[model samples]
Target: MSSPVLKPAAELASTNRTRHPNESADYRRARQALLVEEIELRRQIERVAELRRALPEGGEVTKAYVFEGERGQAAFAELFGDRQTLVVYSYMFGAQREQPCPMCTSFMSTWEAKLPDIEQRVAFAFVARSPIARLIAAKKARGWTRHKIYSDTAGDYTRDYVSAVDADMPGYSVFTKRGGRIRHFWSGEMGMDTADPGQDPRGAPDMDPLWTILDTTPEGRGNDWYPKLGY
Candidate 1:
């Protein structure tokens, strides 16, 4: 079925702008052009989301994965609770690392205040290779209260969904339960292997708000600096 027609982005941009008094005609023209592109970008994001939601039924999750969680030992399906959809994030803490990954920590810090709102729509949790106690300590150090966490103690879930060979990397995955059966819905696949030339690997529609905020500034996200767990 065809989607409804929409107004052209350029028309929308041109019709709704309020100008800065100091701006010149040349600046106005450039700003108007950029606004048009911004409108188009917003539309493209919606289109991509539609495509993602329209994907065919994903593979069934038959493996019996378990984790050490707040409720002690819980099976994979238990993570969903009453919600049909579950969003799991792989945290970059492992038995071999002295500290959790700063980049992952930074990404997660933004999620602190947003977790309550997010959980209203879908079940959410963080899974890591570190023992549950260590992960809880890290969360306490960060001063977060609402994050649901789990340890992939056997690494079975991480190996199948996040990495092979049990690499300490972050992953985003969604699963859905329907008619008493759970299935993998989606997981981010972009990474270093698929990085574009002259750019560090990152997910499109970047999930990290820090980079999103930095991108709006004149300096942008520079090459040298990265977030650290401590100052």
Candidate 2:
């Protein structure tokens, strides 16, 4: 199906109805230019999403990975339950660390409230290298009731999907189940090597809203600041 032809971004922006009392003409002119760019940015975002959806089938998941969670031991496929799609978040809460990575925790805190909305379309799970009890304690501390966390006891899944050596880091991976086969779908690949100058490595359309909110502010996610477990 073809989409209806739309007016050019500049044309649409020029028709913007926003008006602030006592606004200067110079400000209005600059805001109109910014609106045109914002319209183009929206189109670029949709274009990238279309490209992602058109990707070829990803590799099949063959390993018989096992994980232990609150309910007990469950095989990899069991994580999906009934959903055809699964979303997994690998957090930085390995055995070496007494506490979870503050950034990962921050991301999870944002997601904690969003799982219900997300799960309507995909199964979601949180995985870590720490024992199930530790993960549960952290969840309790964070007051998360719905984030289903699992422990990668043998590190098999972590080694393959998260890190080659099972290094403690954060990750987001998606898997799909269909025709009795599960295959890796997508995951954030951008990292330190992919980072732009004077910026931290981050995913396209970053998964954390904290950064998104910060990006709109004048301070603009200052390089020296990071979220601590506490103030």
Q: Which candidate is the best by lDDT?
A: 1
Residue range with the least summed lDDT across 10 consecutive positions in model 1: 10-19
Give the clash total for candidate 1.
0
Model 1 segments beyond 4 Å from truth?
none
lDDT of 2 by residue, 57-99 (tens): 9999999999999999999999998899999999999999999
Candidate 2 Cα misplacement greater than 4 A, ranges: none
Compute each candidate's TM-score over C-alphas: 0.97, 0.97
Q: What's the true lDDT of residue 211 in model 2?
A: 97
What's model 2's lDDT at 201?
Answer: 95
Residue by residue across 1-231, what tens digits does model 1's lDDT show?
A: 989898999889879668898999999998899999999999998998999999999999999999999669999999998999999999899999898999999999999999989988899989999999999899999998988999999999999999998998999999999999999999999999999888899987898999999999989999999999999
**Considering only N, C-alpha and C atoms within 3 Å, which residue pairs clash in candidate 1?**
none
